[model samples]
Target: MQTEKITSLQVAQRAGVSQSAVSRVFTPGASASAKTVAKVKKAATELGYRPNMMARAMITGKSRIIGLVVAYLDNQFYPLALERLSNALQAQGYHILVFTSSNAQDRIAEVISDLLDYQVDGIITASVGMTNDLTARCETAGIPVVMFNRGQDDAAVGSVTSANVAGGRKVAEFFVSCGHKRIAHIAGWAGSSTGRDRARGFAEGLAAAGMKPLAVIDGHYDRSIAAQVTRDLMARSDPPDAIFVGNDHMAFAVLDTLRHELGLRVPQDVAVIGYDDVPLAAWPAFSLSTVRQPLNRMVDATLDMLLAQIAQGEIAPRRIEFDGPLITRGTTLTPKGPKQ
Candidate 1:
């Protein structure tokens, strides 16, 4: 819809003040007298003259925009997180400029430079494969960059992720305690930080109980890949009595593979578990046992960390990892005694 153009000069003329006064009133932290501010408001109201944040950004060379990089929007978790991040940033009077990468190191560098060219106040990389150089560049530019979901050990980069290793370990401990002797894994993409940490932790947890898995396969965080991986693992010389899939998304395919394709009953022939207890995990069709990452708390922490860094010009890099809870459900066999 076409709207009326409201110029600052017109506002100043109506308020009987200089144009600079109007400009100062609109700019954040700009000095303007209370009387002038009130006068500009009155004039703006009369003429429906709204200030343009984008236009002001051009003059200050500060876009107040965040660069949000996502590897694949296909994953329901990412799309859901994207929506929440966008809404949260908007509420904070900032906007997001989205970049969809193929999780490539080269492409990520290019995308980050472009976003920097636009003078974004901060950058958030949700992609699993963002390179070190890209993050270093953002650090040099004095723009805050936060790694969410996937993170690095470098303290120079602020990261917010679920305690992947701990969560994975919890799943393993639960399985072993419930008397699952023959366990297998449909692991996440081994290339990503999330996948590796979970894998390591799961193995560690199993070692504590002195029970090793029958087999483990890399799922690559893809449904088709996960299904194929599950098939191979389960078809081994001695298939596992229980299985742990990387996330809820891949777990669904594993379930289908076992029940429909392989004709195996869950928890009887093969107990199953997954991470990221997404909405569908609770659905009757899936009813999957999984680990729950406190989504709201994670989101809040990420936003708060980014905004603070942006406001302070720069911040000491830090990693903030939160724990996830193991949720027991229908896919696994509950122990006979009191809950382990």
Candidate 2:
């Protein structure tokens, strides 16, 4: 009453090849001659035979699946990074299972546990944090974990990040070179390493220039909160001549607050510089001056480390940092020399 499922054996018989040859043709990273592959593929096409990925994985002891956990997508950068990672992994014969977690610790833990249950070959966490217990569990499960655009104090955890501190320092130097005397900072949440490192570098840069910021407030990487902070800063009689926001997402809100609500002209009444040169920063509406995080390079490094650990059956955690350039736009003054 029901149709029978086609298998590799039937495909091999039709193609005049052994079952093992058909398997080699279908399996990822398996060796097979071009003629054999073509014959097997033709037979598979004719018979409508699709290889069972799960069964193949069982034979290899590798799911060849990566778990991607991300926190927050309001920032355009994260989505772009996710796309790059997905495409890159797919090309390397791997697929990804994505899980979204709020910045909440418990939610992230739950998602990590779910990923582990699926027996993914490795995990990549973007803008998300993991607890000691969860990290331990992952290590015990022999799963390699790589943090993308995030960092932890634990030496056992691997991470890839743009040079946040250096980028921040560059922003400060740019502000100083532009002759902005009263500078303020709307920082990302201090709890995270990216945020802390950026703040530290900005301060150090300012000190190097023999200047100090008017104020440094936490924006928590939120648009509305950044807007509110911008309002409060502008309300002061001695407001900053320039403001450095942690990232371009918040910088947009800060720009809007300055232009619409406060009736201020960018780079005239106040200058704004932000980190993460996201695509929106180049939009005609918001030509924001910001630091460019090399997303492609970062993604490449992340994949390289993740795959290497997976292949080696152990993770000797390493931190990879890439230098990012600052892109100048309409929102900030041109430096004395050639513009970046």
Candidate 3:
């Protein structure tokens, strides 16, 4: 007969101790006598035994894990935020179990349920479409959930985001101050709160300055649509002389088409400004002017809010909104700021 593999029970038996004694010895920072720990380690080394986290959580009532759900990693900002969150959470002795999807909203409840099954201590959501049922499930699970860069219509949920509305208004004023008339807007995906807020702000800014865009088209926050909408705007009989793209990714497409396809001059024929001021916006080829969301600061706020809840183990929900800055560059007329 083949020799039976050693188990924790066998380790306890060999060490002449209770099963729970063997368990404490294997659990990090769990109270155990030095002699018992030494005995358990020796038996475990012989048995190639490892402690099971699910079993340990049953004993201790704490599972040191965070479930991170991000829907739009296709957007560079979400990936950047995810990386920062991973690093930040790891420093706090918590690890992320990532769950990603394009339209994660539909399956969000299912995903949260599965994460609960794994006994994660908390959750951070970057999915815009997260449903009310999922939010309710998270509430019932009694685990802290922080919505990152997105918010629910439900005021009860905790979240952190940039001041998109104000930023939109600020950019609109900047465009008018540059004396550009007949402006147009290449909007973000109307589905997201960020997009909606920015669009609303831009409109308010335009109205405040007594300046209205000649045309406003929904870019749907896609690069191809941004370029195509831009082309449509340019091809019109009374095309806009300036364009404010909802985000830098779409703004880049606007620059390419304007310069290469229609051969328009920047800030001369059609002044182009974008939002979110991603790293590539400063690229030598594009050098696009845009609004900045202070992504790192927002990430810090997300980490701070979530970690505070994790440490406190209970608290009222909180929200943080970071201020955005306008970054001037070659594409749009420079404001009274330091040149790039």
Score candidate 1 by lDDT: 0.86
Q: Which has the higher lDDT value, candidate number 1 or candidate number 3?
A: 1
- Candidate 2 lDDT (Cα, 0 to 1): 0.92
- For candidate 1, lDDT tens digit of each residue in 1-340? 9986989999999999999999888776678989999999899999999887778778876776899988887666787888889998887768889989877678888888898888899988884555667767888898888888988777778888899999889989999878888898888888889888898889999999898867778888899998887788777888888988888889999999999999999978989999888888899888899998777777888998998888886568678889989998899998656656
lDDT of 3 by residue, 11-113 (tens): 8988889998987786655799888889989888888777676766787777778898887665667777788888887776677899875554557667777
lDDT of 2 by residue, 252-281 (tens): 999999999989999899999999999999
Q: What is the lDDT of candidate 3?
A: 0.82
Question: Model 3 segments beyond 4 Å from truth?
Answer: 1-51, 335-340
Against the true structure, candidate 1 reaches a TM-score of: 0.88
Q: What is the lDDT of residue 18 in candidate 2?
A: 100
The C-alpha stretches of model 2 lying farther than 4 A from their native spots are 1-3, 336-340
Per-model tally of clashing residue pairs: 0, 0, 0
Error of 1 at 223 (Å): 0.6
Error of 2 at 141 (Å): 0.3
Query: What lDDT score is found at residue 296 in candidate 1?
Result: 77
Clashing pairs in 1: none
TM-score of 3: 0.83
Residue 59 Cα positional deviation in candidate 2, in Å, after optimal superposition: 2.7
Candidate 2 structure, TM-score to reference: 0.96
